[model samples]
Target chain A: MPNTDSILRFEKVTVAFGGDPAIEDVSFEIRAGESRVILGAAGSGKTVILKTSVGLLRPDSGRVFLFGQDITEMKEQDQFDLRARVGMLFQESALFDSLNIEENVAYPLLNQKAVNCPEDQVHARVEEALTFVELGHTLEKFPSELSGGMRRRVGIARANVTEPAMVIYDSPTAGLDPITANNIMALIVKERDVRHATTVMVTQRFQDGAIMARYKYDRATETLVAATPGDASIAGLKFLVMKQGRLVFEGTLAEMEQSKDPYISKFVLRN
Target chain B: MLDFLKSPVLAVQEFVFLTARTIRNLPVRPHYWRDILMQMDIIGVGSLPIVLLVGFFSGIVMALQMSRALQTYGAVSQTGPIVAITLVREMGPVLTSVVAAGRNAAGIASELGSMKVTEQIDAMRALGTDPIQKLVKPRLIATCVMLPCLTAIADFVGLLGGYFIGISLLNLTSAEYWTGAYRALEYDDVAQGLLKPFIYAIVISMVGCFYGLNTRGGTQGVGLATTQAVVSSIVWIFALNAIITKIFVSF
Candidate 1:
């Protein structure tokens, strides 16, 4: 049975570049307010899936449904309206180098017609978003002026500024150091908990997924606390393991850990 | 073999599609007026000094060369008409576009190629803005509008250079030079001069955008795209100049 609450659905989608399939026959459904951590090695099509979900890359075959509308054959202009409800952080943070942090964060608000954030309120919203990422003081700075971790934080602020219904992070901590990577993960957790936005994170690090599964953000304490057993938020969390353009595992953390398959086991045992 | 020809053929198809889409979007809603103004300031105002310098030098050289040829035919006084005709018909538009193609095309390619390799282009798409509408159209409009304006300036500057040379070196009066130069220009010559740059602007902006958008690999790819943009824009500028000039000549 199809979950009518699904925020994003990829039905037997195959995406290719230059006659080479980047992702093949992949199917997944992300429901509203649920979190999905997609784990894979480089070139496993994790990023491709995220891009296709947002209609950045159209699949060669199969259909993609976002917010109950089929986007597979939607015109580019129509996709822009649909995409306004979704936010994405690219692997490199992908901040517009030409714009300062304030403008970068305010991009969707100013550009997304569906967002329709009025001109007068744009500054306040940008400041609030930057404050959410703890980078309020860096508004005047450009992406090139910031450190790698700072840029990623700015990217996060930009992605969430629209208060999107769903947020996708593509390897938000791909090249960061351990401490910084954990800090980013904590922010992701905080965002997911606070906004209750549907979260889809793609990462190569098992620890990133582990962190998502094991912890929940406590608003009062403003810190991550271990979820009590069978907590609904934690229970709603799921894992997806991809290998060479194919989804090999999709289940809870425990189910993924208990898998007998060598590839799935490798991901679980790595950390 | 057909396999070898596939890449270039596909590239041509993509270029045509990109151009068509850009033209189609010209009247579309949500027009990025701010972006268009910014690009105009960059591509048009930024290239003014170089265009002026090139135009001046080209005129001086033409006057100097034509003086010697006219001396043999006892037509040394005809230097102004010759220089004016050449500048308006050929040298002014060609030199200005070549300059713009070198300056703006390379800049556009590197700027956009960097954005592509870093996934900012993808990010733009995901952020609910069409990269083509936001990025490419502004450039296309700016270049198309500005290139001809720049060429007109270059043409006037080139005439000034020729006038200076005619008075000092060729021993002609200002009246003699200005009168000949002014009378030499016709509506047809001005039309051709302006028309050529407008066409070259399309080639320069579109070729740069096409290569930039398709860039891959990384930083190295940006450098490659910049080079390709300059080379291709200049090549197309010359090829197009010949075709346009031939049509004008036949008319």
Candidate 2:
């Protein structure tokens, strides 16, 4: 179904690397204040689609529109301005090794000129962001000193430091133990609830995708609380399942669980 | 075989584009002054010991070798002039740049290459920071500013080393050595010494950044980039040396 109210849209986008296709004719649209979880097996080009949405990778054919503007051919300076509204969490957590966590979180605030405020304000914002991730005590620690889970949290903090309208998470929990993966997902849900920010998350783990679909952060108790069964808020979240660089299934997690397609059912069983 | 022929042309194209892009970013807003200072400390201050040691030894060796040859012609007093002119015009800048190419170029390549592999560079872009301006421009400025300073240090220490060698090893009088050395050095020779390394500095830094930013494969790719950065930088250093020397001499 075509989404005319898309805050992010990809129309017939095809991306290739060195003559081999990574994502082919992929089309998807994400509305503002909505959360999307893209699930696929390894080598399924989920990350490629996420990158294209953020303008890190340009589509070989067709157009990518961010906030109704075609970024495929946007001027670089304009692109930078456009990118300021979007935040991306890389699969590897991509924190600058040279910078400690405080500097890393403060990077976006410092660079985006419109946010030029006093140094103390920047520091307070950085501290607030780190606190949001529950890693506030690790502010002075470099990325090398953090565990994989801690690094991912710092990546989350840095990504949302500017309170961007759209956030892209590319396999945020790919290589971690299940417990750590759940912890990261909870933080992601917490941020989504608190900021009401639009999110596009790519993950290979079906359980993790389901967890995001089924959870909410309750600010009253300050905890990631599971949504009541059959809740309407859960309906705002969507899922896209990819196989061989094409979207095979797109719907709610309930639809995914009841999907009659053999491939989708197999993923349901395995995950 | 097909790839072999196309590779160098493609590499040159990449280098040219990177050079132009980095220069274009230099005058733009959002200058990374702190990064530039950090690079200066790394490239200039860090490479000092090696540059000084090489410069001093090259001068002493040249004086010792040239003195014997001069004695054969009954022109032993000319040792200081020959050593000074060679060190000032040829040996000092070239040797220091070669040392820098080996140490600093490889360091820059590996550092940037690792950042590329780890996706920190891409993260920079996603965060609205231009990697060329934030990463490459500061490095280019630092290297271009620092290499000449290192060369000047090398040249001065080299002359002092020659003085010591002339007076102590060759048994030449201090007056004869100092007089000949000062007389042989022309303004053009000093200008050539400083000018050549400035050009070489651009070449080395750009080549390093090009290969570094273009790195792929992973850790293995970073290693390959490091080797390529040093080898290519050294090659360009020699090539530019000959070309710049020709241009200066012709003028």
Candidate 3:
């Protein structure tokens, strides 16, 4: 299932700002039900990958294929039709501070014509997503009222409210404490397991301990090995390292650890 | 100068395409009705007091000044036709547009521009939603529709203002003034005035929404967008008003 037909396919995708390439000739593929994390520095075009795939920014060159469809040439309405298949969370929560939590979750649902959903059902889903993120009781609260960690949770809730097949997260753990970041990482893992969603994650965290700690292995009943400790244990989690918008490495977590890739080594060993 | 002319033409074409895209997108975007209603509230209902106040005073002042000036030549009765003609043809339409450009244009541009700064527009696009259709069309539709209603309101209020001054100050009998006003007003004059604002409506709403959709650079960008929306709209309104007035008056 991981490699049959890529859920998302990028072939020679390139993005530039002001005629200078931020990333160039980047290509990668993620299949259905697989979770991938892109590791890179600040200007490394990690978010650009998700932004281009979702049509927030168009690529200067190359193709973006989702579910085997070329999304680059699709009309906005078609893109919108495709939107239900993909959800993205900005590095910041990106909640409408003007709207409170419930309305923020309901924002996307309100944009359709036949939101003939019962208020109770919609309300219930709002609460459910909020509860999933542990922000259930703050439905009327504004984004301004939420803490940084809480806002990230709310952002995750809103992105998942549509039950999208794929969720793109930009630095979900960037500004939080170690404990809070772990909670968000745990939620990211939980969401994939529960929804069986394909996720693309961008993070700078790459320590072996942190990498192993981030996931709980469902390796045929061997969830974790007491002999080894790490910050990531994401089951079936695929990792990609990008440099200046180009693909630097692609492999499993263990493979990344073993490869003598200097960029990966430099990123992984950083304090 | 060459660069300036080139950009304006390119900008106009860009606006035209975006406008079409926005209109074409109306059926897909949700919250359109809400944005439309909010625009109506801002453009039509919110501006009522000022419009009424201006219309009334302008009407009264027109009657007074016209009557006095005409009376010096023993043609005071001509005030009726003169005030009626000016109100129906120019003041009612142009003033209404100017007011709209100041108020609703600023509001639409800033609302959109802030959304841009915050990535709410990006969020919409990511959701496969068209920003113009989701954000621009409703406001544009609301503007064109609301302007006529506002103009009509201005007409009624200005006439009443004329009535107040004419009867109380000029000592013109109510019957004589009303009869003369009705006699002087023509179908084409009123029709032409109502029609002129539609273009201004386009200028106001479209320009405002355009600035918003293209907003970047955070808070300063939004503020600049708001200012640009109002300034561009007012300029366009006056320019179009001049062209329309020439066509109407010649008729």
Best by TM-score: 1
Error of 2 at A98 (Å): 0.6
Whole-structure CA lDDT of model 2 = 0.89
In model 2, which runs have C-alpha deviations exceeding 4 angstroms? A1-5, A229-232, B1-3
**lDDT, model 2, position A176:** 94
In what order do the candidates fall by lDDT, top score first?
1, 2, 3
> CAPRI verdict on model 1?
high
lDDT of 2 by residue, B1-251 (tens): 58887978988988999999888888998889999999999999999999999999999889889887888999888988998899989999999999999988999999999999999999998888888999999999999999999999998899889989887877788889889889999999999989988988998888888889989989999999999999999999998888888898799
- lDDT per residue for candidate 3 within B1-251, as digits (tens), equals 58779878887898888878766766753556876897788788998888888888889888888888888998766666778888888898888888888988898889888888877778777755666666787888888899988988887778888888777877778787788888898899888879988778888888988888878798999999999888888988888888888887787
Against the reference, the lDDT scores of all candidates come to 0.93, 0.89, 0.79
Better of 2 and 3 by DockQ: 2
User: What is the iRMSD in Å for candidate 1?
Assistant: 0.6
Q: What docking tier does model 2 reach?
A: high
Per-residue lDDT for A79-183 in model 1, tens only? 888899998899999999999999999999999989989999999999999998899999999999999999999999999999999999999998999999999
Clashes of each: 0, 0, 19
Model 3, global lDDT: 0.79
Error of 3 at A246 (Å): 2.6
lDDT of 1 by residue, B1-251 (tens): 58999989999999999999999989987789999999999999999999999999899999999999999999988999999999999999999999999999999999999999999999899888888899999999999999999999999999999888999999999999999988989999999999999999999999999999999999999999999999999999999999998999898
Every candidate's DockQ is 0.92, 0.84, 0.50
Instruction: State which candidate, 1 or 2, has the greater lDDT.
Output: 1
Model 3 achieves a DockQ score of: 0.50
Which sections of candidate 3 miss by over 4 Å? Answer: A1-4, A109-120, A175-179, A205-213, A217-235, A254-264, B1-6, B25-31
